[model samples]
Target: MFTRIGRFVVRRPWLVVVAWLIAAVALTALSPKLESTTDQTEFLPSHYESVQVSDLEKRAFPGQEDQPAAIAVFQRADGGAFTDADKADIQKVATGLQAKHYAHLTKIQADPAAVSPDGKIGLAQIYADNKDLSDTTVTENVKQLRVDVKELLSGTSLKIGTTGPAASALDAQESGDNTDAMIMMATLLLIVVLLGIIFRSPLIALMPVVLITLVYLTANGLIATAAKVFGLDADPSSSTMLIVVLFGVGTDYLLFLLFRYREFLRAGMEPRPAMAEAVARVGETIASAAGAVVVAFLALTLSTMGMLRSMGPSLAISVAVSAIAGVTLVPAVFALLGRGAFWPSKAWKREPKNALAQRIGAMTARRPGLVAIVSGGLLVALALGALGFKADFDMGGSQPKNLESVQAMDDLQKGFSAGKAQPTQVFLENTGGGKLAQDQLAAFRDKIAGVAGVAQVSPAQPSADGTVAQYSVSLAYNPMEDKALDLVDGALRDQAHAAAPDGTRALVGGTTAVLADIRTAVERDYSVVFPVAGLAIMIILGLLLRSVVAPWFLMISVGLGFAGTLGATVWLFQGVKGANGVLFSLPVLVYLFVVAIGTDYNILMVARLREEIRDGNDPREAIKHAVARSAPTMGAAAVILAGTFGVLMLADNSMLQQMGFAVAFGILLTAFVMALFLVPATTTLLGRRAWWPGLKEQAPNPAGEEPVLVGSGRTSG
Candidate 1:
């Protein structure tokens, strides 16, 4: 099937190229603008407690202001306590900000009591017009608010800084935009330089950059169109992920084909026929590898979190698009370039000795049992570190500490309770639609204040119709801390539910509560998505290899690589670096990249092993030759892919750093240990049984000539 495709593409390279161009243009012109949100609450299902609280708030507190409010903190520039004059100047700035009628500004609130006990700081609240904390309008308002605050504070001793959800969103977006540029620039440079070195041809180095760019535009357009048509809430980070996956995996598939083409050329085949043959040989492996990634990504749809559900399909689409381009567009472009694809270099005409690969291969063939034991032991040792893994739900904690919002948060903690800046709220709705007495509200508030973690509770504020009452509860600890999440998720929630009046329903809502529910959802996803993805990948492997037993062991090896990668990350971030924990999403992110992308190396190695065996080489000789041949391609591809992810370590975000290290390290392990040493050695040990239920005898040679096995010029079978 792939042979036919290669033939057709090579015959009409211009036509294939033109078709891709037209499709790219049309898709870009027609697709809707891709949109993303930073609102975590939107990602949760309506059935979750956090979402339920949100719904109740809207219905019962219809007139209540839902917009996120920023706090403007003022302090004397000389580090002394604010005097009466400084305090008066701070109030003047707050009044001036309110009068400016900024685009999203709703109101401003200031009070003398808001000053700290040390008299070093004063606070003013700037409310936004929108409910979305990360909305562009709110972000814009924050930008203008900062500028206006600075202008108003001119010539005064008091200086102002803002913090809160709106300010944080603005700062985060700016930081992310800069980070995205860096990531892209680094990825492209790595691909170009690495490819140039590998092929010794500038043209070949730039080919993937040019072609994958087109694929990225097309994939993004298609994703946007799908999101629009299906009303999916695609995460903002999906675009960044798409860029890496397309370039990394797309380049990988191209390398697989190109290496095979070069091999055939060295065997004295013509360029066109060699290209066709290369496709025919490597197409199934590429398809199977992509199938594993697509299935793994699609499995995210089963996730209870809307972000994962949407991201799964979006990433699946990207991998599918990249796979298609790898088989079609890439081959067509190279067909036109022909021998010139490696112009200015004659390396493609000769095969290098690759001494390291040769040595590893020879060792594996000679001492399969020892090689297997060593490789397996290393993975087992690394896997032990995963037992200490911890999850951090504080998204802001991953942001750079130097960010204005982070600085503001620190400042706020000094003047108030750690949780006072973003207090948790408990909502009580009268089930019977009756107004509650003040005495009943007081009793409920007393019950909540009595909870061990509760620092203070504000008097109940009733809705206009008196059907619901809300109380702001501040915790003794920082709201994003594990202690706070535990308190809200466990005792506080339970106590609130139990202490509600006879006809009232109690629901807790806030940042901490939302994170607590998200933790639950993520835990649920681990159970469901992992098994489904594992089963799906195994099916692809089984079908590709035409053997059930091979897929089982292959999956086990990949699984070990995944656990080792995660364990290594845990050791580095939590155990060694003394981080509170890695990002809550680390496990899922690691699974997606390591398990799915790592399988590509396994498929390439195993496929070559089968081919070597079919050529009449004995099990041990086949292991040596297959490893010698496939190792260079796998190693080069792994390095490039791993390096691209490693660029994330340059990011200020700790989450990105963790992800970068984990995925990159996993790729190296998969290529070096599992795919290279362990898999081939185990296959040699298993012998013909590894290909059970499939042909064990040597395949017939089309030339009707005896097979000349590598390393030994002996004819076999």
Candidate 2:
């Protein structure tokens, strides 16, 4: 099957290339705009309490839908108490901003009652006509608000800063834009330089970049089209993630085929036939490795959160596109290039010494048990850090510190309640369809105020028809903190429900409530996604190796690698850096990338080991030979992919930096420690038993060695 595909693609390179171009262009033209959703409510199912509250609020309090989108924090420029003139300037700034008629901002007002008791600070609330922060108009309004406010307050002693949902959304979008550019440029540069260094050919270095970029556009178009057609929830992070995955995954698969092509080239085969043979030989392994990645990602369909569920299809699409391009487009391009793929780099025509890889292989072969114990022990030691891992739900905490939204929040907190900017709302509904008495509403408000974290509760404002009453509750803690989440999730929610008057039901709704529910959803997803992805990946390995036994230990090694990676990240971000918690999605990201994609190396090495054994060499000789032959390829690929992600450390956002570290370190660990040391060592020790029922190969020669097939020990770089 793979041979036929190879011949077809190699024989008709132009047809293959033309088809990709046409598909990419047409799909891109037809694709709809993919809106980035930061709203947590959109990620939840309607069955959750938080989602239900949001729905009820919209229905019962339609007039209140257009709330303040941002808060303009004002203070005297010299850090003194605001004089009457400064107060007048603050009001002037608000009125001027409002008069501009920004796209989403409907009104901007400075209320006399909003000034601090010490007269050191004042507040001007900015109201938006719509609530969707992801809407482009919201960003434009926020940008213009900043500009207008600065110009409006020029000669006065007043200074202003903006903080609120709309401002944060604008900042997040800018941060994402900046980080996306750096990641793309850095990833491309890393791939080009590393591939150039490894293969000594500019042609070979740039080929994967060219092919993957086309695949990226095609995959992106398909993802957007799928979301539009199926109404899938597309999160803000998915697009940025897609770019990184395509380049990293595509480059790995490209190396797999290129090394095989080089092997055939050295065997004196013609360029086109050699290219076909490379695809024929390595195609199944590439496909199976990609299958593991795809299934692991698709398993996210089981996630309860729409964020993960929708992200599943988008990422899975990119990997599938990359796999197809690996076997088809890649081979097609290389077939046309022929020996010119290597260009001036005649090193492709010579066998590498591979001395270091040989020494490492020999050491493993000589003492398989010790090698296994040492490598396995290191991973276990690091795995201990996983116990200390803490999940942070405060999404705002990870944004760049220099962002205007963050700085504004700091200023606002000095004179106002930390949670004043966005307080939780308690909605008491008359489920029996009767009006609630004022005294009963007051009693419920008192009950909510008695909760430990509730600092204040406003008077109940009954809806026009009086079927629902809303009370705003301000917490002592920041709304984004875990303390707030705990307060809202546990005592506050339970107390609200239990304390409601007869014929009434109380529902808590706000940022902390949404985050608490997300925590529950994420916990549920872990139980579902990990087991399903693991089982699915194990099945793929079993099929690829034709050995059930190999799959078991392979998965065990992958699990250990996952734990170690998590542990190391916990130590770095949580322990050493004193972060209150790591990003909630870190574990899922590590598992999908490290456990699923990292298996590519294990598959490559073990497959080579199986091949060497089938050639009638001793088991130890095969381990040594396999390790020696596969190491350079694995090392080069790992370095390139790891470096691609490590560049995220340059980002100002804490989440991006942490994400970059975890994946980069995990890939290096999988390649250098697990694949190179543990896997080969364990296979050496397992000997023919590793193949189990499929072990029909010639038994190891106990008395002496027999020379294997021609060129069995030669190395290709």
Candidate 3:
């Protein structure tokens, strides 16, 4: 099948090249203008308590504006109350915001309670004009409001500072931008230096940078299209990840193809034929490796977190696009470049001693069972960590501490209840035509306070029309903690609703409620996303390998890799690190990166195995031959890829560390164990029957083509 494909591509190389160029141009042009949301509330279903509460607020207070996403907090240097002149200046700033018609900003309140304690600080509650505060227009309004506030406060005794959702978001954006720039520059330098060292050719080193840029543009366009067609949500973090995956993983794929291409060229094949045969021989492996990664990313759909679920499709789409580019775009471009692709370096025409890979390969070939047992046993032991896995959904905690929002949260936690930063609100609304008495509301608050897990209940704040009253309920644990989420969504909410007056309705909202909703969204995503991704991967595998049997077990092996990675993470973070729990989204991320990228090695190994078998070698010979030839490429690629992810451990955040460990470790395990030991051993045991439906045939070698096995063995491929 691959031989036929090679012939077809070689015969009409121009056609393949043109098709990719045209597709790249068209897709790049038609790519949608995508926007990502970091708004935690947006991911929740409207039926969830937080969403319902939000909806009820809008309905009950039809003309009321939501709170401004940001606020300019003004304070006197002397810690004194604002003078009438200071008040007037603030009012002028507020009046300008009103003139601008900021979405969700109805009016600004210069009320005294809006001020902080010690009479030094004061706040203007900038009520917005619309419900959706994340709109671009709203962002612009906030920007203008800042300008106006600065102008109004000019030369005044008060010092103004903005600190709220918008301000914090802007700060985060700046930090992320800085991080992105630094990471990109660092990654670029790393890849160039590493590749340059490896190939000893500037042209060869620069190829990945150029190729991956096109891959990035193409993948992004396709991902945007997929998101538009399927209604997938992307987060702010997606761009950083996309860049890394495209360059990092794309480089790995390119290395895989190049290594094989170089080997073929050294064997005396001319440039064009060597390139063609290279793609033909390694194409299935590249496709399969990509398929495994795609499947693993798609498995993120099975995550019970909206962030993970949404991230699943976004990343899967990127991988799929990269995979397509790997086979079609990469091969076509290389085909056009021919031997000159290695300009100034005739190293491709020579062979390396490669004593290390050869020795390891010889050992594995000699003692396949022992190799398999030791490697497989190590993964099994690490898998035990998964039993202690716990989930933490603390979004606020993930935010950097330098931000005012985070600092304010800490201050609020210290001064008041920890829940003051984000309290759980229980709302009781009038269900009957008649309004309930104040006593009924008080009684409901009492009942809610007495419920299990409640720390305290603040005095009820009545709605403008008095049809609804909101009571803030504090909990003993972080709102994102499983126990707190369970408390809010389980007994507390249920009990509050049950005990509500017949004429009144009840709903829970705020941080805990939002968390509960997020959990539900994640659960729904897990059910929908994982299956689609897996099916897509299987289809790609089946197409590449032309065998139904091969794709299934490959996926199963990758799945085990995922489990082992997660379990290892649990042990490291939960047991060793002494943390509350691993991030709720960690498992999904590990599954996506590890399973997907890990599969690349498997695909490379398996495809080589098949190629060996197709050349009329028995399964045992194929396994030995495949491992000997492919192990070096796989090891090199895995080291580079794993090293990239390993840098995430340098991050200050625990979440990034967990991700770094899981993905890096998983890649090593996948390459060393699953791909090298398990796959080869299983195939060796299966022998000729493994390639069922495509029986082994001792066909004559093509004219002028000498059979080349990895170390002079009668291996497959």
Candidate 4:
């Protein structure tokens, strides 16, 4: 299959190149603009309580203000309590803000009751016409609101800061934009520098950047088109992730092909025939590795959250497109360039000794048992750290501490209940289709307020028709905190549901409620997605290796690598740094990259070992030669892939930092420990049994005779 593809591509390289160019241009021109939502509620299924509450609120309170609201908190410049004059000035400022008529801002409401008990802070509610907290219009209005408030208080002795869903969303959006730019520039620089160092050729370094850019554009367009067709909501982080995966994995595939092409050149094969042979030999490995990644990513479709479901397909599409390019566009370009692809670098004509890889292969081949034991023990030691792992669902906690929204939140906590900025709401609706009596509202509010962790409960506000009543309940803990999520998910919800008026149904809704539901959904995904992904990847490995036995140990090694990566992350963040918890999504992200991409190294090494075996080398000799040959490519690819993710450490977001470290470290482990030593050692120990039912009937001729390549009729000596 790969030989035919190589021959076809080599025969009409221009045709293949032109076809890709046209597809890229056409797909990009016609695809919809990919959009993302940061609204957690939107990702949840309607069956969840928070989502149900939201639906009920929309129906029961048709005239209710669904807009996102922020509180502009004002304090004295001198740290003094608010006096009558200061209070008057605050009201005046509020009135001024209302007069400014900011776009997307619906209203500004000021109240004497909003003053803190210490009399040092006053608050005014600013409402936006947009209900979507992540809406760009809401962010724009909040930005303008801050500027207008600053101007309104310019001459006064008061300072103001905003905190709430809208303000936080705006700050996060701005921070994300800055972070995205940094990540892209850093990733590109890293790829160029690293590739230059590895190959010592400007053309080789630049080729991947240029080719991957084309792949990135095309992949994103196709993903956007698919999302538009299927109504998938792409996550805001998808674009950033796409850049990393396309460059990291795309470069890995290119390196696989280029390194083999160089080897064939050293073997005295002509440039064109060498590239063709390289494609024939390495194409199946690239396709198989990419298939594993695509299948693993597609497993996210089974996720309960719409965000994961959308992300699954988006990333899968990216890897699929990248795979196609690796076999088609990439090969075609290199075929056209011929030996000039190496440019001034004459190193391709002579094979280097690669002393380090040779030494590793010699050691592992001689002492397979000791090698396996040491590597296995190291992974076991690291895995223990995962025992302490905890998940933090607080998205706000990931933001930089210096941001205005974060500062405002700190100030708000000083004067008000921690949950004051975003209170939980419990809506009680009349299920009997009649007006609910006002008398029953008090009992419901009292019950919710009486729950542990409850700070205060606002008086119930009934809709005009009296069919529904809404109560704003504040918790003593921050809405994003685990205690708050627990109260909302368990006690508060239980008590509210049980204490509702006889004819009404009570539902809880708020950020905390949404997070609680998200936690449930994520926990469910762990059970479903991981097993499905694992099984799918194992099948791919089995088919690729032509042995069920090799796939089992291969998957186990990858699983160990995954555990070790998670444990290392927990040690760095939770134990050493004393963080409360890692990001809630860290496990899934770790599994996706560490297990899926990490498997690439495993597959590459094992495939090379099989090739050596087919060359009539004994198990020990095969392990040594395969490691000596494949390790350089594995090391280079792993470092580049790991470095790409390591750039994420430069991000201010904790989620990005954790993900960066976890995947980067995992790749290094997969390359240096599992693929380089443990896998080869284990295979040597297993010998013919490793191939089991699918063992080759006869080894290829040891003489320099052309041997058939997998999935291809063509042969290469």
Across 127-225, the per-residue lDDT of candidate 2 in tens digits comes to 887767656788788887788777788888888889888898889898899989988998899999999999999988888888899999899999999
Local distance difference test, candidate 4: 0.88
Rank by TM-score (best first): 4, 1, 2, 3
On the 0 to 100 scale, the lDDT of residue 591 in model 2 is 93
Which numbered prediction scores highest in lDDT against the true structure? 4
List ranges where model 2 is wrong by over 4 Å: 63-65, 697-717
lDDT of each: 0.87, 0.87, 0.71, 0.88
Q: What is candidate 4's lDDT per residue for 170-224, written digit by digit as tens?
A: 8888898999899989998999998898778998888899999999989989999
Full candidate order by lDDT, most accurate first:
4, 2, 1, 3
Candidate that beats the other on lDDT, 3 or 4, i.e. the better one: 4
lDDT head-to-head 1 vs 4, winner: 4
Clashing pairs in 4: 1-711
Candidate 1 residue spans exceeding 4 A from truth:
696-717
lDDT per residue as tens, model 3, 462-522: 7777888878787866676788899988998898889899878899987688888787676
Residue pairs in clash, model 1 = none
